[model samples]
Target: MGRSGLPPGEDIIILLVEDNQGDVRLLEEAFHDASIANTLYIVNDGDEALDFVKQRNEYADVARPDLILLDWKLPTLSGEEVLKEIKSNSSLEQIPVIVLTGSEAQTDIITSYNNQANAYVPKPVDPDEFIDVIRTLENFWLSVVRFPTHTDED
Candidate 1:
């Protein structure tokens, strides 16, 4: 059971930070097909992602996500910046962040890891492959990892 008092693999929340509409739609479809009973929250830019995680402005009522799927390239803050902020903050650092990006560059991968991103996956061009990746990701992160119960604090 997690901090939420739910059994393992139940009621996990994920925050996806991606600006591309098409990619967002594809991820949504893929997550649905994966059949995981988890809530996915979407933020279109890095700035909004920060706000959501910080529980500020319009996001004060939302819960902290169990996982974060971040795109390295983003408007406003950039995923790298968001990752750094999350890792540096004591209240949010426990959540695992995965860098899901279109760039396969070695620099992007290294930078993401340096910033404490838990995993890096290049965005697959094929929809089917992307869905499979999501399924695998769900199986490992949600099923295998034991997350700390969330708390709201500085």
Candidate 2:
């Protein structure tokens, strides 16, 4: 068993779909001191993010994410489009997706929820607050809630 206590290859897995370098760096730094075992996979744009989640092309060997943290604004396909795609697909729909972005627009919030986002978190401007939020999110989503570790056999 690993540090998270499931199995050898099963550590808490997270996929972050973000384009901002600073935001990405901050998120990485926040997870550096995490208590549980985890692996964070990053995809800078929506297209690449979709490819990674679908396990297509270069992402064929990548582990499926237990949770996906997605930024609302992304290049190529927008986060809204990605969320719609993920939710519509049967194989991908079960993965909990949280919309983590700086935008707090009422429309964006409403749209995210309408499209079936598991949660929507507004990014704090202060780095310390951001880290604190990440830690709190990690504690709740990773430790408290149980995600499906095994994919159903096709």
Candidate 3:
């Protein structure tokens, strides 16, 4: 794990946009088991996730997350729509977004990358495999990758 009291430049904030309660709990458990210290924020739907990213309404004080884990299927707005909006906005485009979904459709995979998702991982149905996937994802994002820095302040 990164050092405690990370400088703003090193902070790893994750925004998770998922609607399934069980999956949310599983993700939380996975993070806990991994002993990661970074902050993780959860939103139940894509529209609200977009609002949070845009810093509207209740999200006005929220920090822009370094990474986003988005589900392809969401209420109100789809993840693809949210991804497009984020990539389209100059201020938000550089933030890495990982598509975390159960869909294995080739079209969804291609479209997610086409819409500028940084990565896509199909959700695993098996409990042990899901944990492994989460661990691998954590390792890749928090250890192996260097993400672009955000200079803007809202």
Candidate 4:
């Protein structure tokens, strides 16, 4: 079995809602070496993130993600707003959504939890540290937890 607890060939799907291109690349590199098997789908803006999760427009045929990593700073709609929408939706609420942002603001952390975020993680400044953080997140979220399974056909 893979680290996520699914049978050997199955892969966990993760949605990353981040606008920063540099952070996205770092995440890609980190996931490339992660111990668990995962398919990371990225949305560069908040609007696209919502659309992707809600399966709107171009995202209509995509598989629903088992986990989500959200960033606070984004273009168009903000992360708080996106988090609210996802949590309010019955179909999407079961998927774990973690707020992964650079801000260590008490307000941001509180707001994320208020909007029903499953967890909150601060971004590390150093590139190597950032990768290590991602690996740690993957280890706990992917290896330790048994992810939700969607019964609906994709």
Candidate 5:
């Protein structure tokens, strides 16, 4: 195991469903700076995100992600809709989903929780603070929590 004590057998897969290119860059840089040993997949819209999750078409050979970082305001299927679909699916329900959004509205938070989002974090405006948020997320998910092991058959 590395610093997180996660299983050393493979790198964790993290899927980020975000439409903002700037935010994607920030998240990428932060993960690299934090030295997280994982694979990051990016999807520009909610439709693509769902496609990736369902392993349809181009994503047929893609590995299922261990964690998902979702943004609320998205093009095509809204993030709330995505969350509901994931939570309702028996095959996908076990995976942890963290909402990293700019909206701090109470309604958004409550709706996310009601849909079974594992955690909800508002995006930090400051670049450094955003990095800190990513680091904290990495620490908690990779070190403090135990994730279900996923195999090809899963």
Candidate 6:
């Protein structure tokens, strides 16, 4: 069980769909600092993230994530596309998705919320602010929110 008391057998899994290596490193450091116990599964592109979530082909053994952090811009399929797919699927729609992007545009924010994103966060330019934002995210989602565990067979 995690510090959040999320059942004894279930694991807290986070799926991060981002392409930037620097951002990935920063997120890793921030999670460490926050002392959140969870498994982070990373994929560079949106298409691969979708495949992992669906447990397709090479990702047959992939575990269902408790939450997803999606980036706006990606190499193959865009983050919006991935979000749409997840929200449209009955089995996956219940999982919370936090749209973490560098985009601060109004249209992007509106679109993200329209697509059933649980929260939208604008990426901070400053490293310290970025870490703080990550910490806040951990505090809210991990410590406060209650997420469902995956039990049904895919």
Clashing residue pairs in all predictions, respectively, total 0, 0, 0, 0, 0, 0
- Mind giving the per-residue lDDT tens digits that candidate 4 earns over 1-154? 4556566778899999998999999999988888777899999888999889988999998888989999998899999999999999988888899999999999999999998999999999999999989989988898899875567742
Put down candidate 5 lDDT per residue, 1-154, tens digits, no spaces.
5434446757778899999999999999877765557889999888998889989989988989889999999999889999999899988998899999999999999999999999999999998898899989998886677778766676
Residue-level error in angstroms, candidate 3, position 137: 0.2
Instruction: Write down the RMSD of all candidates, one decimal each.
Output: 2.2, 2.0, 2.6, 1.6, 1.7, 1.7
State the lDDT at 123 in candidate 4: 98
Candidate 1 global CA lDDT score: 0.87
> How well is each residue in 60-135 modelled by candidate 6, as lDDT tens digits?
8888888899999899999899999999999889889999999999999999999999999999999999999999
Clashes of 4: 0
How far does residue 77 in candidate 4 sit from its true spot (Å)?
Answer: 0.8
**Best of the candidates, lDDT:** 2
- Taken over the whole model, the C-alpha lDDT of each candidate is 0.87, 0.90, 0.86, 0.89, 0.88, 0.88
Better of 4 and 5 by lDDT: 4
Error of 2 at 87 (Å): 0.5
Better model by lDDT, 3 or 4?
Answer: 4
Tens digits of per-residue lDDT for model 1, 1-154: 7534446666888999999988899888877665557899999999999999998999999988889999999999989999999999988898899999999999999999998999999989988888788888888886678777754444
Identify the leading candidate in terms of TM-score.
4
Tens-place lDDT digits, model 2, residues 44-137:
9999999998999999889888899999999999999999999999889988999999999999999999999999999999999999999999
Per-residue lDDT tens digits for candidate 3, residues 1-154, read: 2333235446578899999998999888877666545678999998899989999989988889878999999999999999999999988898889999999999999999999999999999998888889999988887677665555662
**79, model 1: CA deviation in Å?**
0.7
The true-versus-predicted C-alpha distance at residue 53 of model 5, in Å, is 1.0
In candidate 3, how many Å is residue 49 off? 0.6
lDDT of 2: 0.90
Stretches of candidate 1 exceeding 4 Å from the true structure:
2-10, 152-154
